[model samples]
Target: MQKTERLVAITVLLQARGKMTAQRLSNILGVSTRTIYRDIITLSLAHVPVSMEYGPGGGYYLPDDYHLESAIFTREEAISLILSADISGNHNLFAGDTDLHHALVKLEAVLPEEYRIDVMAAREHILVDTSAWCNKTQEPTHLETIRAAVLNSYQLDVLFSDTSCCQVHPGAGMLWRRIEPHGLVFKGLSRRHARVGRWYLVAFCQRCRSFHTLRVSDIEQVYVHEETITPRPNFDLHDYWREARKQLEKLKPPIIFKLHVKAVARYSTLHGDVTILKEEPDGSAIVQVNAESMDDAISYALGLGADATVLDPPHVRMAVAQTAQAITKIYS
Candidate 1:
């Protein structure tokens, strides 16, 4: 690794546990003890607060509260950071002080003059069409609390709003669920179709008497429970979600539909699924998939908008028409 990269790595290692010997750092960085000392001085010159101790327990340490004020990046590194931030920004995932905009500002401030222009040019031209789905107001804080509980392997007593019914009773509506959070899954598509962009916290709900997928937004309040639920030894998050998706699919009646999608080269490159049935001579492709019910299939087609068309199962076309009429009645 380059000296600058090594410096960043060293800082991260020291910060992780707050202390490390020069010899240990030297071994980890594949440099000599003398090189480690020189790098420490270099870091200090760059305004990093590093302290050194002597004797048997001697080592280098950053104060517990020290924070990284700046970072060094190559042009490529800068672009990657900006693009990642841009993508996340599109998702409405960064609405607060901790968002991508802040990170970009810091990066631009510290970036070398030679690479600044390229970074700015890339930022100016790169565009991400995030889904229109907006995050729930309390999502960030709620996610953090749930994450902490999950990491600590603690049970959660959560007040949840069940959305299965059309109208909810005001006073007696709240349900308390004891959940053992397993993992988080960002399911469905973009934010615009937010009902589709459901962020689920997969958990074993004791009250439900089975595993459940709880929407993050549906959680009203959470209290960390005193008990910790032990996860099964063979539990794997990836396998769990795969099974969940399949089970969900099974619950819906199978509706076969075909779509002729006018695949935009640029857009397709980013979001297209090649695993679907067919690709045409032109850039356009035919897609074949099964939805739970006719209504579900029609909704999926509508989400694709004019870019796709229903080419099979003539009944699906009627179903789509009826759904459109029903939706239009609301506005009418």
Candidate 2:
């Protein structure tokens, strides 16, 4: 590769990897260790914060918050980026990032007149709207506050919504809880839940003292502690999420109930991973699904209109009957 490209590559490498030894950088870049050292000097000369550690265990590193506004993208990459950004919920995914809009505007402004047409043409033909129907998409409150707590590692005092509070006394206030902010998990099209592009706060609850996952929509108010917090030992985001789901299963045992579905087409409303156990000759299916709770299971059965029937978990059947009676009484 060219020296200029190599320099850009080195900057990107350090930016991504956070730190790398000269030997390791050389191996990755297919250059001599001497060349790596020279490149480091070049980066430092260019005002990149390239720091070195003496002795063993450390080599070259950048500051924890070092970020360069500059980036290089190819013609196709630039077009793809524009198209993708256009569909990112009108730049709402970034929460409070005005820079995202600024960067996009700058990128478009600098593109050649001919290249601008290409981007606009692609967007005209291809629509990428991913909003859920029925206005079920939740507008989470206090996202900026919650996000800041996550970044600064501050404890959050959250007024989280609870089912008991909602049902028992509608006028009652929300429950107060303290969560040690870990990070925010934003859902995209990749996740199967009906509610797409929702934010989830994954943190360690002071009450539970373990890990907790609460939907940001469910959190009414968030009060952040200015004092920064130290994260727990061996806290891996992916691992914690995986284990949290497992714990959720124990607390609210998975309802492995069968459903009789008459829909000839696959129902998009059926959220999350589901297993199709059997298919009848008549375009109907008897499938097994996992719901978080009995109430959810009943809702699933009811949502199918007459097309679905819950075959197991007799309590769900009873609940369905009671709900139907209540509805009938209201309409009667």
RMSD (Cα, Å) for all candidates, in order, is 10.0, 9.4
Q: Per-residue alpha-carbon lDDT of model 1 for 137-248, expressed as tens digits?
A: 3353487677667555689988886532213334456677677887677666322233345567878867545677777878889999868776564565667788987876
Model 2: per-residue Cα lDDT over 53-141, one tens digit each: 97867878878787643444456766766665577644354546554445456657667777788888898899965655554555576
TM-score, structure 2 vs. true: 0.63
Residue 273 error for model 2, in Å?
3.5
Local distance difference test scores for all models:
0.66, 0.67
Give the candidate number with the greatest TM-score: 2
Ten contiguous residues with the weakest lDDT in model 1:
265-274
- Among all windows of ten consecutive residues in candidate 2, which has the lowest summed lDDT? 187-196
Q: List the residue pairs that clash in candidate 2.
A: none
Residue 324 error, candidate 1, Å = 4.4
Local error of candidate 2 at residue 276 (angstroms) = 3.3
